[model samples]
Target: MCYQLVERFSACRCLYFQHAVDPCEAYRQRGHSVQEKVVLVGYTCSRHSMRWSGNKARDSTLSDSGYSSIKG
Candidate 1:
């Protein structure tokens, strides 16, 4: 039997929101504005779920030999 499946992934960039000031007294001593744009970084990871047969007994009866093999 051949099994087929599809997976989905999505990502979006966030717009600039706010600025912050450094209170360490180092940036202030340099006489430069410490305000900076907030940047967002993201990623996606996936786990697999088998599509078993509709019949519970049939699903259970299927051999486990190739069940764990993954195809990207």
Candidate 2:
């Protein structure tokens, strides 16, 4: 059996909202803001549903003779 599983990734949740800092000089310099959105700086996953990024070999149940032996 092929132990190969596709890696799944999640979107950023913290960037769901937009805000403007009052003390930010750059914002004031523009006279008006371009209404810029927050660029996602990191990644996240819903660890609440399924266990994520755990030890593969140790937690895996697949047989040792599987194709995973040929680690490319």
Candidate 3:
């Protein structure tokens, strides 16, 4: 029902532009649907988490506590 063009630049972030464009009711006319096409606007880390900075801190070795550290 609408055409959405997503735009974003971030090291770690997932955002959806709320501005929805009017879509042609017929897929043949428009060529794509929101459900069929996905627009991802962010970055994902190893744990499925967004990166907070452009340069992510290197993860250290993990211990039995499920944490990464240089000295564990």
State which candidate has the highest lDDT.
Answer: 3
Q: What lDDT would candidate 1 get against the real structure?
A: 0.32
Clashing pairs in 3: none
Per-candidate TM equals: 0.21, 0.22, 0.27
How many angstroms is residue 52 displaced in model 3 relative to the true structure, after the best TM-score fit? 10
lDDT of 2 by residue, 1-72 (tens): 112123222242433233444344454454555544334422443342243465543232222222231257
The model with the greater TM-score, 2 or 3, is 3
Which regions of candidate 3 are displaced past 4 Å?
25-32, 35-72
Candidate 1 residue pairs in backbone clash: none
User: Can you write out model 1's per-residue Cα lDDT over 1-72, one digit (the tens) per residue?
Assistant: 112232222222333123334344455355544444333322222222233566542222222223221367
Worst 10 residues of 2 by lDDT: 1-10
Better of 1 and 3 by TM-score: 3
| Backbone clash tally (model 2) | 0
The alpha-carbon deviation from the true structure for residue 10 of candidate 2, after best TM-score superposition, in angstroms, is 6.6
* Candidate 2 residue pairs in backbone clash: none
The TM-score that candidate 3 achieves is: 0.27
